[model samples]
Target: MSADQLLDALDPDQREVARALTGPVCVLAGAGTGKTRAITHRIAYGVRTGAYTPTAVLAVTFTARAAGEMRTRLRELDVVGVQARTFHAAALRQLSYFWPKVIGGAPSRILEHKAPVVAEAAARLGLGVDRLSVRDLSSEIEWAKVSLVAPGDYAVAAAAIDRPPPAGYDRTTVARLMEQYEQAKEGRNVIDFEDVLLYLGRILQERRDIAETVRSQYRHFVVDEYQDVSPLQQWLLDQWLGGRTELCVVGDPNQTIYSFTGATPHHLLTFSTTHPGATVVRLVRDYRSTPQVVDLANRMLSRTPAQRRREGGIELIAQRPAGPPVGFTAYGDDEAEAAGIAGRIRRLVAAGTPAREIAVLYRTNAQSAAFEQSLAEAGIGYLVRGGDRFFARREVRDAILLLRGAARARAEEPMVEAVRSVLSSSGWSPDPPSARGAVRERWEALQALVALADDLAAARGGTTLVDLVTELDERAAAQHAPTVDGVTLASLHAAKGLEWDAVFLAGLSEGLMPISLAETDAAVAEERRLLYVGVTRAREHLELSFARARNPGGRAGRKRTRFLDGIWPEEGSGRRRPGAVRGSVLTGEHDPALFEALREWRSRVAAETDKPAWTVLVDATLEAIAELKPASVSELSRVQGIGPAKIDRYGATVLAIVAAHR
Candidate 1:
């Protein structure tokens, strides 16, 4: 209830961050150093001490999920009035509020379906841009917009960044496409994602009234992951601050991985230079990853030359106990690599690690195919993060948008019926196309809508269509990094700000980790940092694996990534033998028999209820049940993360498993 009660929960360094109530405070919060906890507690502490009201504090984060988590944490701290928003969310909110009065009666519609629109534009220009190329072009446009480059200046901008167009395309042609894309969107009266910030920045710069209003409303500001702040995003932040110095920004430059999307750590690295009187704090202790994993991350970053420029370089001292030694394994090919990873994941799950707590991280999205196939073959459920966003699918998005529009109009219709009507209007059918592929995928997505309607109806007990639509919007915003129960298959970039109990870094070979696309020295260094990010995602177990051949018909000789030269096992009478895997990844002191029995019971319960094993009981809870050898239902209730609901449901089964094991 007291400020000190919350402050005492943090480490001494973290406690200082929580107590700093005024001025420009910059925290170089390294991975898993409880950065969110520190920032949340700081706001709570200020509110508790009457230094600032909750409404006076504005907490900004890079992602909607992060903002949502911050809001949840603040609420838990009993400080519920703070405004936590992503840059786009906050800007759009203010822009939406002011646009009606300043510009017109209504704000410009945001361009949601950019890829298809861009593809249509390309078709009009008689250019056959494939899906991949369309996605790349969309990215290029986003980069230019965030960089504040005009369509006419896009070619020069691309050249300045030493970035050429995608293969088989020229810069001038791409520039023309970008122009046409803008024209098409303008024709439709829609503004793309980047315009959210651009519009806000323009309004704040031109209109003093709106700026003053926002500045007055939010007197104190805290920004998480300041390293990823784009130039335009930084401009928006400055407008919100309006020369006021009560700003607390936290980020680690080593984790700056979004440079390709116009995000740079420059803003974070130069914060103190801009605000000379800023109080800087460095958090070096890593509480998320084990010593072995932290050591691997440090070793990878230490090899990079530019790491020193980012303030105190990443010297992450692992505060956790020494975990298993880092394991490096070599595979004959991608198939073998995937199989190896799946086998290990299965072993970890069988050893009492929840499937959701294990992750397989790779360099590219394309690399997920083999792993997905392997996991499916191993009967292990896994969720891919990048490029597989369910809500981002075109048909699903169209259906949701239609429902949202109808809901906003306050249509007197049931939400489920509204969903059905929207899907039908969108030309989605109950029966999937006889043929497989895109049509089938769309059909499946629409079917999922029906299922979601039923589930929401059951959960909300006959909620209004408008409320359901609002729920959809909230879910979409907070779904950036949704925690689903499965083996996490994510690209290294997507794996940032996330941690796992056991992580398998696959396709660690040279052309893969640094990917042949990293042409420049800066790009190569970023690639190394990406590796560092992936390594640090592992908390207890870290396994780095590579393959000699990526595909069956690919080249014969495949070398490990140049970044891994020092950390990876060496070949031919070196420190570690080539093609040799190091350390047992499935090491734990818990009784293996009891653990397996608990897992068997969990699987059975999960199947009976059609839920994830973790939903019945997480691996940690199961491990506790096994290790503590709970003799009865009452004893099982004492395990952490197990509550009255779990005790009422699975406690008896868990206790029986323990007794049977004994």
Candidate 2:
């Protein structure tokens, strides 16, 4: 494809972003605004136009999967040699290459046995923490280390901030545990995840030659999802840049939801201030969601404080036609919410949307249990998007390795029998672990692997051990599992950069959405951004549901999310009601004043553009526009079928229409 082909799919705003490949450029790309396309094409255009050699540019992503996808896209554009990697992976690679020469014999081993080690440390501290608590502490330690908070200073730092450690544990207790965990890791001759960044940053700062070599190798840098960058990661980026500024960052501050993990939107927010004369572009066109969904998202943000929303917070303008009104469901309890979500998924799949195209998203993984039980009872197949990959699970890997050994000895054995024998020989007991929790979960995973072998063999008409082994090898290489056609179950965080035809956002109650622990204003704002992420994930259909009661108990003291206030329209006023709470219906009521005003403006814009009023803004669309009462041209253009071209032509008149009515 030619260079023009790359720019062909991009809108005018996106094209401008793609073309600006030099200097400091910040793209405040809203959800579904085609940010990935813009960045990828920018790199591609630069490489094709001889402005940049592919190897000289480096793109950093948050996840290895995201980096892989970018590399795939770059390859498709016939642009190879550009390095795309996660920060950890990049650090690990550089550390690995320079370790023997710079530090010593070898770099410290990266911590892999985190849970077990944390459990041991807690035991040593006489803390008696459960497996989950151990894991949470490990996470807390990671956050502290990456945030540059030392163990001795942990208590003070944590107390100074509103964010608390998991399990409501006091900072003093966390500090003690953190110190113990660090000592334990050092004793075990290991370094945790945060150490990767710390080590890389230290080496680069101390070893000028090594830093200079890396900087000379990669002249340009692109960081995606710049909003979720931690301070430590930003420090590493600065070290890599070494004051030579040719950086392009793409992110939406409204989507800054990982503050608890030490990520802040501050870097993205002050990009222009940090790099004076930076090109700051905002992409508001949302091509993923319908007009209705986009309007709801915009309304949600519009209710947020100005500081949280920020200056570059652009309301998304949907390019798709208005679809069905978003469903706001209030359930009697958790069970009802799960059943409601399952029923909706079944109906959507039966109607047309594939099960794979529909996702059930929640605030946390624990919320998956109710939905899982309901979906199973309804005979629905589903996959958890954020769970351990089938091939990557520890038990599954162990089982496969044992199977390989057993299959080598008995090459002619049936695959299922071979799997059974290997599992049995490997001391995999049928009885659950003595202490139930993580161990039991591991055993269950092993049993699942055995069951999978049986199912795969049966499906393939009595396959041999060799075939099963070969299948595992292929799947391990592909980093995918056996194809299980099913609906997707994912947490809101995991559902980022993904879309679904229909999405059911469960557990929208006060405690869950803001997550109870989110106490400070900043933390609460992050929680709201998390929900905004969830809201924008739906492409066509969206169902926001909340249970009145969390458990099987009756509804008592259950309250709706405060964020919903001043967002959902009330019955007759056709305006947001501040006191409106959950379980209240968002009725569609068109105000005569706004409707008349819109009609008048539509007529004027149509006359100026030499087109019919319906062409400028059709009656059905005009009705949606008036009811939505979007305050700006950016928002006015979100009214179905209004793309950038029409926005350029009739946007001013439409905004004046709503302004006159107000």
> What is the clash count for each candidate, in the order shown?
2, 0
Best of the candidates, TM-score: 2
**All candidates: CA RMSD (Å):** 17.3, 12.3
What does candidate 1's lDDT look like per residue over 1-662, in tens digits? Answer: 79779888888888889888997998988888889989999999999999998888888898889999999998898898899999888888888998887889778888886788889789989998655467767877787888788889978878887776652478898888888998898888889889888888888888998888888899999999999988888888887888889999999988888887889888888888999988988787788986557656766765332334345455666677555657788787777788988898999999999999999998866566567667766778778886675556666677788877877775777777777777787656666544222344455567656655666676666677777777667655544443457898898988988988999999888876897667789989889889988988889988888889745445659888888764565464232322122221122345667976776776677567654344465444554555567686656666655789878877777777778878
Model 1 lDDT on a 0 to 1 scale: 0.76
True lDDT of residue 382, candidate 2: 78
lDDT of each: 0.76, 0.76
TM-score of each: 0.71, 0.73
